[model samples]
Target: MADLKVNIGHLALKNPVMTASGTFGYGLEFADFIPLDGLGGFIVKGTTLKAREGNDYPRMAETPSGMLNCVGLQNKGVDYFCQHIYPQLKDINTNVIVNVSGSSPDDYAECASRIDALDNIPAIELNISCPNVKDGGMAFGVTCAGAESVVKAVRERYHKTLIVKLSPNVTNIADIARACEAQGADSVSLINTLMGMAIDIEKRRPVLSIGTGGLSGPAVKPVALRMVWQVARAVKIPVVGLGGIMNAHDAIEFLMAGATAIEIGTANFIDPSVTIKVRDGIDRWLDDHGCHSVREIIGCLD
Candidate 1:
């Protein structure tokens, strides 16, 4: 078998396959469908300092080849996660990364600090770029200064593998990524759903209640790959490529373009067992190429 191990900072993953946050809820919801240990890691739903009810109804819309969501980082808050969710996750053998989000730097720091207390969670994916939330989220991810401020504050409070999830909505994603690295981000994840909207001509209304939502799935794959490639070259730290990853082929494309690891997002909703399929497919691909290590194909774009 090919060696599928890879490292994101001090945290070591058995493979390069992980499930994206929001798409995977607390990593427990899919327990029956997938073997949790087979995954490199699974980022739980977005957690905040306080529980958010999220936006009104009609938060999801199905696009041609993708889906749009304005879920608004709905969660039961960090306290609930630490008190209730942590116990259930503590025994899991695989890496459990928390997807931390907030409206302010203090919120991010406080949440990260709280998750840091969890013995099972080895890393935190700082979500400074969630477009669905009207208060903060992607607000802090669009600008260099905004990204730096949040990351800097979290770095001081939370000590672990700090992975900042970057927003693709920005003009220069590389600049924002570089700022996160400068502020002590251990790793970076890219292309967190591009902003999109759909119309209901018959009703003369917007499909989603929020009018606009973040788009994911195969439609955004090209843009996601381009951003991942650019950001990977721009940052020295590892880059977790996500967005529009439906199969192992799509995942491999991201790896060759320059992602250290790939996260399956919308695909999980279509097939809960997709994570294992991607992982197995990658192993087969690696072995077929006579590559002993999955790392051999990473950034081998030439």
Candidate 2:
């Protein structure tokens, strides 16, 4: 097998395939389908400073070739994660990352600070796409200033591998990525679901509880590849890409577009063992192509 190892800042991955936050449900939920340690890493569901009840009923809607969701970062809060979840994940023998979200810079920093105390957790993917309550519900990742504030605050407290998850609902995503890098972000992951909506014509109403939600699936792979390519050229820090990556071919496209690593999201719902499949497929492809390592194809696109 070809060497598939890659690094995101100081954190090393056995392979480039990782399960995205929210879709993977803390990694433990999928234990029946795939071995937990077989993955490069698995980011748990979105966690905040305090507990969240999430959105009301009908928070998810299936669309053509994709799905929309406004789950609203539901979780039992950081303390519960540190107390109950950490112990189960600490000895899993794979990288366990926390997806940290908040309404303000302070909340993001405080939540990250608490995760920093966990010895087994080597990284935190700072989710800046959350609605900023202090700023009239606008997401902190839409603008450079907003992205900077949260990254700056979190960087000050959390010292490990800080990977900032960028929102696709922005005019210049590369600019927002640069802002995070300026604030000491160790890495950046992109194309965090595009804003989309579905309507129920028969019922004359919206399909989801919220009128709009983040879109993910094969429908978004093209846009995600473009953004990953653009941001990869713009930032010096490592770029992690995700959005509709369903198989090894899709994952290879992201790596060629300059992503050091890629995350599997919606595909997990369709096939629980997709992560392992993608990882193995990547190795097979590399061997077939005469590449000694997966890194040989990363950014090899011309």
Candidate with best TM-score: 2
True lDDT of residue 8, candidate 2: 94
In each prediction, how many residue pairs overlap at the backbone (N, C-alpha, C within less than 3 A)?
A: 1, 0
**What TM-scores do the predictions have?**
0.97, 0.99
Error of 2 at 229 (Å): 0.3
- Model 1: per-residue lDDT, tens digit, 15-40? 99999999999889999999999999
Candidate 1 total steric clashes: 1
Model 1 compared with the native: what TM-score?
0.97
Local accuracy by lDDT, each model:
0.92, 0.94
